[model samples]
Target: MLKPSIDSLMTKINSKYTLVTVSAYRARRLRENPELFQKSEKSTSVNYVGMALEEIDSEKLTYEVRDKDETTS
Candidate 1:
């Protein structure tokens, strides 16, 4: 079973696609730099991906939604 349940992660990120994308990107960052971890709570997992999920669960990690129109400008 995943430490941070999918249900919990959904609350932090309303869209499933956005959640996966955000976590994946964060996981990649952790892989490159082991010091980018933002979790300060009792960790439930040691892996980079798990760490990213935990950050989301603890509300330590968040994402902003930028309008597509704004990006192409």
Candidate 2:
């Protein structure tokens, strides 16, 4: 079973789209550099996608909300 529930993950992230975006980004990073992030032995059962979700669920990985005006400038 997935350690972090969907509800929990959703709470950390603003929207489902954002969750997917963040998780995908983190998963890609993990694939490129496995040594950068540390995972518990239990995480071995799941693949990188799950690992990424776990990181977000645990608060190990976080995202910042940027104002639209900042990006538009």
Candidate 3:
């Protein structure tokens, strides 16, 4: 019989994770109070059409305003 090392066991433990589904309202609730959930930093790159997120200072933050002026010839 062979035994796995401590590092191998730790790697297995870190590799496994559980995911849960939440409704939009429930998501809002969770977002409003992030301290209630086990938090993790998620890094993602997104290509948006017209809006840009410049800051997120608070739990419920919003982006800045942009002027939309499209002149049709």
Candidate 4:
């Protein structure tokens, strides 16, 4: 089973696309530097992606969606 279920992740991030984007970004960071993980001791996940999901479920990691115009630099 997934450590952090998709349903729980959806509560933290509204859209599936955004959730995937944010988790993937965070997972990459975790893979590059495992030190970025805050729930290492508590998290049951053994991989970076699972850890990223756990972080989202625990509200430890978050993403901000900027205005559309702001992204159009």
Tell how far residue 10 is off in model 4, in angstroms: 1.0
Question: Runs in model 4 with CA error above 4 Å?
Answer: none
Pick out the ten consecutive residues of candidate 1 with the lowest summed lDDT: 36-45
Global lDDT of each model?
0.88, 0.82, 0.27, 0.88
Best by TM-score: 4
Clash pairs for candidate 2: none
* lDDT string, candidate 3, 1-73, tens digits: 2122334333323321210111233345445664433322431312210001101211222323245654433
Count of clashes in candidate 3 = 0
Better of 3 and 4 by TM-score: 4
Q: What C-alpha lDDT, on a 0 to 100 scale, does residue 43 get in candidate 4? A: 81
Tens digit of lDDT per residue, candidate 1, span 6-47?
A: 999998999899988999999999999989897675886789
**RMSD of model 3, in Å?**
18.1
The list of candidate 1 runs beyond 4 A from truth reads none
What are the candidates' C-alpha RMSDs?
Answer: 1.3, 2.0, 18.1, 1.4
lDDT of the structure predicted as candidate 3: 0.27
